[model samples]
Target: MRIGIRPARVVALLVLVIVIPLSVTSVAGRFMGDRVYLLNSTPCRVVVMEQHDGHEANPGETVLIKSGFVDRTPTMMVFSGSAFWFGGLHFTTDTLQVRDQADIAIPPSWLSSSIMGKELTYELTADGQLLVKGPTMQPSMPQPKGLPLKARATPDSKQCRRG
Candidate 1:
């Protein structure tokens, strides 16, 4: 007695095996959101640039982020004037989440350098790795003397209401 296998059956079975897993993975990625959360623990204020996607791609703008003290949203991106540091990297389908947690401490040096008004990009991996496209060169500006804004007392109360 001899046994033989059919070529059509073998081809069909191979297709099923290959196609099923790929279909499942693509669907899962869409629903998973692929979210990454950035929690800030430092006391100093940080700035970040964020890409605003709408019908068309728009130039990202700088966002002023405040320090999170056990309460507040964590900054997803830190803008060093020219360069920006993002919390994570992923495809456009992925979601980026920024939250405030008192436990996560970012290195002071990471936020102190400027990119010389040139655009630079950096990302923090999900596994806690930092990657930079280029070396950070410029130093942060010196703090101003005295208060940032000096307020003077109004001589007359009516002057305060003037536009």
Candidate 2:
């Protein structure tokens, strides 16, 4: 007796062997990609600093994150404190300033992180705690001066009044 293999059966078996393993690997890869493993990591606290009346004060804002394994970037929207203190015409206005940087750093506690063109420092302790320092406040820029416009009497207006 002689036996022969069908081409259609061989192709189907090849497809099954290749596609099933690929599908399984892809599913496993997705789960692995979702998880981030950092070296010797635990829960940590983050603090942001603020200034008031030439003195530093705690804004009481805190963020808890995993140490050595945070990935984040920030776009900042701030009010530009521009003011021109003149007599009577006190021109004080708040301008919206936004800065977008495509280059974002990884993780919130990855030692050094850069956000909104400002470099932030992160310190991790052995006791599973973290501290993050924000950028210093800069001085405000000089505001625009409001100038008085002198109005002149037009000769045409006087002639039109007669008509």
Candidate 3:
């Protein structure tokens, strides 16, 4: 015995098989493509150092300061982030004069002049905890006489772990 289907039925089945899977695959691809992920979870290093007197920081400026580790490499610091959401580490010093231009400007500086060239290093973890080594002070190159301070965060700093 032999069975045969009409040409019209065969064409309908072919269309259904091709069109349905294509539509489903396209939808799934779009859903997955919308998301972004950073593979390596290593923490980013951060440092907050003393700013020159009369320096004004704007809304979005990133600064590099020395690291507390023995290597004393330069690290990035921002006014706002996991560690310094309200304000990061604070220090005070007599040799160096620093100012806080934020809403609350303290006459005495939180970061000391001693840390002028030194880098106060911290590790920003994925969980929002800032891990900092003991504050280390180093002599830093002299900053130009006049420069306005600014608050800025790096690309990695801006991303928080997805819940």
Q: Judged by TM-score, which candidate is best? A: 1
lDDT of 1 by residue, 76-110 (tens): 34422233333332211111222331233233333
In Å, residue 130's CA in model 1 sits off its true spot by: 16
lDDT, candidate 2, at 123: 26
Q: Which rank order by lDDT, best down to worst?
A: 3, 1, 2
lDDT of 2 by residue, 45-129 (tens): 2122112111111223222211122233122111111211111110001111112312222333322222312133322222322
**Evaluation by TM-score, superior candidate among 1 and 2:** 1
TM-score of each: 0.23, 0.22, 0.20
So what's the TM-score on candidate 2?
A: 0.22
Residue 40 of model 1 has an lDDT of: 22
- Which scores better on lDDT, 2 or 3? 3
Would you list the C-alpha lDDT of every candidate in the order shown?
0.30, 0.26, 0.32
Model 3 residue 39 lDDT?
17
- The runs of at least 3 residues in candidate 1 whose Cα sits more than 4 Å from the true structure, single-residue gaps closed, are 1-5, 36-163
Model 1's lDDT to the true fold? 0.30
